[model samples]
Target: MPRIPGGATGVVLALLLAACTGGPGDAASDEEAAQSPADPAFVADNEAWRAERRAALLEPDGWASLIGLHWIELPAHYVGSGATNGIRLAKGPEKLGMLQQQGGRVWLVPDPGAALTVDDAPAKERIELLPDVSGTPTIVAFDEGKGQLSLVDRGGRKALRVKHAEAASLTGLGPLEYWPADPAWRVQARFVAHPQGKTIPIMDITSRQAPQPNPGAIEFEHGGAGYRLEALEGEDGGLFLVFADRTSGHGSYGAGRYLYTAAPDAEGRVLVDFNRAYNPPCVFTDFATCPLPPPENRLDLAVTAGEKKYRRP
Candidate 1:
């Protein structure tokens, strides 16, 4: 997989002359959306999906909840808001706990009398944990559950990602604007599966490199020009696409946008719907780990659709 999920690209290059395609889990959510429905009901469904996406983003622990990302550089460091801690927290209690890293393992030892919880239950003892990079990460909840902490593994570096319900992004986010929905932008694509167990290099905004599962590439036609995009394995079992278009920096997030598509059917047919495209989590919070679009996924044409650049207040 890709190094960071900020929040969390393209079809691979060998197929650039070909075609291709994360947010909101399974995307517009209508895997069975008619090939090109321009009807009012279809439009309404897309609107509803967008509303859900907006709500999800503002969840207490959603991307907007992120407030800080502190790298764990030292072997042992105290974490808290006090000035004495080695790894000082920007928020939370003055003396939360101690973090000890040794022999490739990290453990959290909460300070006595500090009110901390492990996954919602009171943290009565020290806890061994893994970073978000490999498997499920343990959430260290503090400040009476209003704030929480978790470990993230980025390019072999472990860091703490802090989140809180009071983070500014949750209440300060702007409304999402979209280009007029059009059925024409919903192009039909064909999935060409790669050989069993193939992976490709994925470069993140930080320029870190990692091999991501490359199930195959998706080929499609848009505006009379044929194109292809390399597909990454989405956590939801569908395909994830990272792409950049002519709108970058002008009307969209400069790095690019992301989209999630349902798995190709038996015949390998899929819909590359532009209306469902969305901004990466980085657009909302600086604490995110977003990946950049692979060169192959950069499109010459402007994709005048989907969520626009998020203007931070």
Candidate 2:
């Protein structure tokens, strides 16, 4: 399995080759030069973007740091590293506390002797723990702020998402792999608006389905073939696309990849950059609840750009 989501991997030889000689020599260099735009600014911008992407992944609380995911099925659970606890944590004090789900809210009663924090403040009593659905999940920090636990709601099911700075996945993460910086993968597409309030049922990795906003679709021609991707709402009015192509499981993430297109212009034109396509969070960690591509978004074309599959350390 891949080690990181929003990421991909290269064979061991290719990774070592990339680390030592910049890349696989002549053929790789030729491919990059042929697909790159003549404008130096394009390459510079892509480089800047890649640097920022790596920075995000390296953050202490980034996706790579994820270590555990525990479901909350009962009304109450004694969470701790102790074997006797109902919800045994992967890491923490032997007796962390009691988690009680009452009505629609969740509360945590910390162990008096356990050093913990609720939203960074010292925890000494029971406190309301907000779920992610509230737009601000309460962060329960332990291990001297190196470990964090947060409540997440997925399709009305609740789970504890755990992360630790010293996780093997983070410290042992390998270098990112890619097909190369290709300008040709950046194509201009037309956005076709959907009916007002249209929604699509999207299934996540957990097999739970939920209706998500379907604001529009992006239609583009790649390699002389027509393709359409149902667009989901994105940050700042942009478009979020989850799709699978011929490259899936061959040279990319098997589940699929993700892409973001800026809001369409007045003329309904937008640029879809396949080079910026990325793997989902599930690619890196099993704890992630990433959405799979809907049937309508699967394409037959081989998109030989963007991220390759991720190799774990």
Candidate 3:
């Protein structure tokens, strides 16, 4: 529930506080006061709001616990040795199960009549066994040429397919801390135009290759340091970014954290608020494969804004 800058509640609070102080007969004046131009205090309040959200994202139960990753290869056999091998199930001592591959498709055989379910639906034949984050047996089926899967559970919910693997935020945990939130990190960045539309490659927890759309980069300045962030287009059309700054490795998440921005305005402008940057899903579980920021996305300067590393469970 940490607030991000420009969040909705802050606007409501400002209006309510104004009403409490204004005369009942001067409602129009109160409305005008609320609509007045932004002030220095308003900017400070926004920064504080962003800081709260930053902290919440890095908190335990956030997305950083991902610590294991495995890929489903052709002839998907479940190997049970070593830490990074095949799928690590929460089942019994057997540790490993049987997997078969035929016609470019893979399937798993749960212990005979294993009370398994896919997305809460009763078990079905010829379906893919997926990791169950909800503590139930789940299966998934993929379309012929599509990268996504159709997930089904034991109870019957068809949910979006997701993979399990150790995320960078989970593995790169050293000391969970952050630099103080300095307003200097809040800067107006210019979005560069990329008419051709760039493509950024991402490797999921399964080490599967997925191509993310890169619309362009945001250029900003902080404390005499200049930085650029390359934007990745989310499946929902939102903006996503994986970036590393000077504090990475030593102070921030080694693989890097994520940030999002709304679509650009008519003038093609957006605020690259570092105060809202947060840890990736890998920070909370070992079942998330988060993409690391590419070399070009690594910034040489320190960005002292947003949440620090997560320290508590």
Candidate 4:
């Protein structure tokens, strides 16, 4: 199969999805053509979105930049790059600081002359480090601001997430492959609201389970079959869907793919755009604890749209 390399322009769209070919008069191809919006504006918008997505993944602190994730097991431990430290970092000063967890709070005491910054400001003394759960996690930047260390709390377990500007995963990242953008994959679905205050147990790649807010389910029809995806609360009150189709491990990411939908309209309608589906952070780094798709979200259908599997450079 021919893969579209990263940084390619929109002109290459005609050459996409070479593995899934069909004759010009094929029934499926005709149906997709009929459903596809020919508006130049739509094409331009999708192209722009793809450009933004590529730029985000290539950012210095993006998902591909992840280097390590060190769990804080002991109450207090030395954190640095030296082998003698209790929590050795992949990249940083030999004696970066001391991480201590007291009660329910975590604190970082920088080493003298280590030249660390807390949220971009100089840090010379012990500082309380906040986790992502607080909606504003404290960032401890070192190595001339190229290395970022942040505290993340997952299912009550806290750990240090590290990222570097020059991580091999980022510098050597391969292109993002995708199925051809077919409008037939964009279906308008119905949102069935779940009982208020309901939550669902979500398991991550690390095997830790946590109950996340479950607002509702998006019910849609494709290829004459009905399907449903449990929707989690997403950014700005949107709906986040993590799902696996028959393509998993065949042509797409083995674990699953992520799709985001705008908030349902007053009439309970949602535009489920499968073309925007993307891979999770786990695809770019092994250190990420990405969520697994719940059984209810796994579909037997072969969704031939959205992102394909990622290949390392």
lDDT digits (tens) for residues 117-174 of candidate 4:
9867899999899998898989999999999999889978999999999999998888
lDDT of 4 at 242: 83
Top candidate (lDDT):
4
Clashing pairs in 4: none
Worst ten in a row by lDDT for model 1? 3-12
lDDT of 1 by residue, 1-313 (tens): 3211221123222132232222222223322234444789768878998999988987898888888888889898998989999888777989988998988788999987679998678896888767887678899998888899999887787888899998888767788877656677787899989997998787765556777788899998875788888888875557899887766655666677898888788899988888888998888887877776777787766676787778887
RMSD of each: 7.0, 7.0, 15.5, 8.0
- Model 2: per-residue Cα lDDT over 143-204, one tens digit each: 88988888888777888888888887788878778786778789999999999999998877
Candidate order by decreasing TM-score:
4, 2, 1, 3
Error in Å for residue 86 of model 4 = 1.2
Q: List TM-score per model, in order.
A: 0.86, 0.87, 0.58, 0.88
Candidate 2 lDDT score relative to the true structure: 0.78
Best by TM-score: 4
When sorted by lDDT, best at the front, the candidate numbers are 4, 2, 1, 3
Q: How many times do residue backbones clash in model 2?
A: 8
What is candidate 4's local distance difference test score? 0.81
Write down the lDDT of every candidate, Cα atoms only: 0.77, 0.78, 0.50, 0.81
